[model samples]
Target: MAGSRVLFFEHTLSIKGFDKALEALDWMKEEMCKEKGFSRHDGGDYYDHLVATAQDLLDVGIKDEDIIIACLLHDSVEDVEGITVKMVAGRFGENVAHMVDLVTKKPGVDYKVGDNLKRYLEAISKHPGASLIKTADRIHNFGTLKNATPEKKLRQALETEKYFIPFFKTCRGAHPRYAKYFFRAKTTIEPHLWEIKEHYEEIEQLRDQLRKQERTA
Candidate 1:
């Protein structure tokens, strides 16, 4: 799996019923597949990430209907041109829509850079359920971080360390029911950061060695 062009998340467990949530998943899968602009960077289908994220939630024993639906559609408002918070509300109810909106980055702002990242994390902290969904999203994202450029992998791992680690810690306090799951997520993600950072360091070392050889020649 590590050598494959795309990494797949495999889980045998699935939740049944919740037809509306499944309906929302179908809707998101269709939209994500058709949208030429959306990029997964992991060389996998966008819908796979959504299902993996929702599965992460279920793995941690979070079976809330709205949160699950939010996990399925969290990126729709941001990535799909025609999808709106209002449209999501009309179809899946306000709770799902609201959580999705809360996690969606603001328009024209690069949520991964500068103060935008901080503000995005802060906004998500206001809603515990939204925070959990975001955490699950990150866990799945980083867990499958195989095909991205080394720079992206390093920067994102650093961001997760500096911002998301403490954010998860704080969430543990406010969301007692999810505390253990948050801890598990934190542990799961931290090791990836270390691995990426180490890989980056090794690359820099090789670059330095090559530069030295060129200079001596």
Candidate 2:
């Protein structure tokens, strides 16, 4: 039901000062569309994913309008060509831009290798607003990961267990105003990760069984 309730550009623009947020959304949509083949794992429009991320924040009772705006454009700097923090600041004010910058992965940093990921998570954790939006973003990502490849699904599940679970735990203490929401997100995400992990284990077992049968035959 939440999927069907996405806050469209028209609806969001009417929300008082959020009219400016439509500019960011427009820019994001244009850039994402221009980058042909850009899409969710399920082949849905990528802009839909951004809208869903913002809606997740709202559904969880987040009242910080800037955070919502940040969510709407969070991936722009990272995934969109020529988008920059300064560009975001000029349009949406500094706080929203700062939150977006905080979540964007730094250039040349391989998140799956070495300390890059740790430092990235640390930066986000230091800013509660960024962490809030990042959490919502991941919640959407994990929820829709069923359409992802098995390798990607396993990798995400493992990463969530290794990094996100602990991060969400700390958020309860560090972001008191949002603790309950973080907890709810954690509870929802963990079970799904468990299911993925279990599914993979079953697959591995079946592979082993087939190998043993082949040798015996």
Candidate 3:
């Protein structure tokens, strides 16, 4: 008994602390508002985008407060130059920061985007919460991909089918209720999937132009 001095543990519930998580969501939105999304004023509404991603998580049965917090902060580190993973960890707790950090792509460098994206996808696949957030991120992004250049949209669609749909399926398997909710959002976007290929000719021309420019540089 003397040797068994002390051992204690605590359990936390999302339902209990989720209100605080919403407050962090507001903070993340404000930071993102000062930044651009996929592009400038055209991507004018990051707040809406972040909210939509969060809503997707909610719909998919991800009620963990930290995961929800990660959803709100996902893009901030990737898109906003000054923001750092440490800052998020400091504010939201390391668990939330680590999840967000897992999904945040590193700042641009000379390396190939394709290779980086493959690595990014691999990392996301390892974490259930990260996978869930990314799937929501892609689902919302697909809805808005029309705002991207034809080439960009086509590339994204191909990648989504190649990589993301599989990850979404994994997320779907994580919970019994998730497949239904995830597919409900998927149905809304399935109607638009055909359009991603509509501008192949234009996209190819744009790609040729960019390739020529790259070669010249």
TM-score of each: 0.87, 0.91, 0.71
In candidate 1, clashing pairs total 0
Estimate, for each residue in 74-160, the C-alpha lDDT of model 1 and write its tens digit: 999998898999999999899989999999987888866758888888788778789999998889888877888777888889989
1-217 per-residue lDDT for model 2 (tens digits): 3235445533755674666666766776777652665688787778888888877776677777788889888998998788899999998899999999999998888899736777787779888889998888889899999789999999999998898888887777888988987798799899999999999899999999999999999
**Candidates ranked by lDDT, best first?**
2, 1, 3
Tally clashing residue pairs in candidate 3: 0
- Rate residue 154 of model 3 by lDDT: 75
1-217, model 3: which lDDT tens digit per residue? 2112111000122345576566665675567663544433354646566666776666556768788778878888888778898989888888988889889877664223566676787778677778778778877888877567766777777776666666566556664355665465456555566566655766779999999999999
In candidate 3 the C-alpha lDDT for residue 120 amounts to 82
Residue 106 of model 1, lDDT score: 72
What are the Cα lDDT values of the candidates? 0.80, 0.82, 0.68
